[model samples]
Target chain A: MSEYTATVTVRLKAGVHDPEAETTRRALERLGFDLSALRAADQFELDLDAESAESARERATEMTERLLANPTIHDHDIEVEPR
Target chain B: MSEYTATVTVRLKAGVHDPEAETTRRALERLGFDLSALRAADQFELDLDAESAESARERATEMTERLLANPTIHDHDIEVEPR
Candidate 1:
């Protein structure tokens, strides 16, 4: 087995309310940045041991489903590469 | 001016305590994923208007410095593309 790093990007599903993003946009506007709209996401990077990139991705996907992302309101993508 | 989208990825600086990331890693480990270490970040996407991509990037960078990222403990990257 080899060490690998998995990158998971979790984003709110379309139509989901994102108060943090809204608050961030307001803060930017107050600071004089002309932003019309905004959205936000959570990214998680995990280090693990796996036999191959494909296996690493599989573990990352399962991890996202179980903890890294809330499937009811979030969607996620996983990328794995050798560490 | 044209509409553009800016993607900002904000991550904790090295040595910062990341409780949320720790909790996530614990949850994943509980689910049988053998992770060694983990880090987490917040990503923000903004829609705005600018004269060009360069201008858009400049605005996004300013936003990151002032709002999207906390320079004291966070590092960020900004990417802008025409919408």
Candidate 2:
């Protein structure tokens, strides 16, 4: 087994309401920062043992489907690298 | 002005307490995934008009300093791309 790090990024799907991003945009505008749009996402990094990068990515994808992301409203991507 | 997108990632500084990450690690472990460590971060994507990518990066850096991250306990990185 090789040490691997999987980075999973989860974001609300397009057209989904994102209150946090909206609030952040408003706050930036109030601070005089001009922005047209904003979006927010959560990134999780997991360190684990796996046989290959593909296997690590598969595990990360499973984790995302099981817990990190809500499939009904979220879209996620995963990247894996050897550690 | 050219349109640009700024991506800012904010993470807790090393040695800083991260309750959410700790909880996630435990949850994943219970699910039978063996992991050595886990960490979580917030990523913000901002679309705005700027004269250059440098300006966009500067604005995003300012946003991170002002609202997106707590300097005392968090560290951040910003990337800007022309849109």
Give the 10-residue window scoring lowest on summed lDDT in candidate 1 chain A: A25-34
Q: Please give the RMSD to the true structure for each candidate, in Å.
A: 1.3, 0.8
Whose DockQ is greatest here? 2
Tell me the tens digit of each residue's lDDT in model 2 across B1-83.
99999989999999999999999989988988788899999999999898899988888898889888999999899989998
Model 1 docking category: high
Docking class of 2: high
Question: lDDT score, residue A4, model 1?
Answer: 97
Tell me the lDDT of candidate 1: 0.87
The estimated TM-scores of all candidates read: 0.94, 0.97
Which pairs of residues have clashing backbones in candidate 1?
A: none
Off by over 4 Å in 1: none
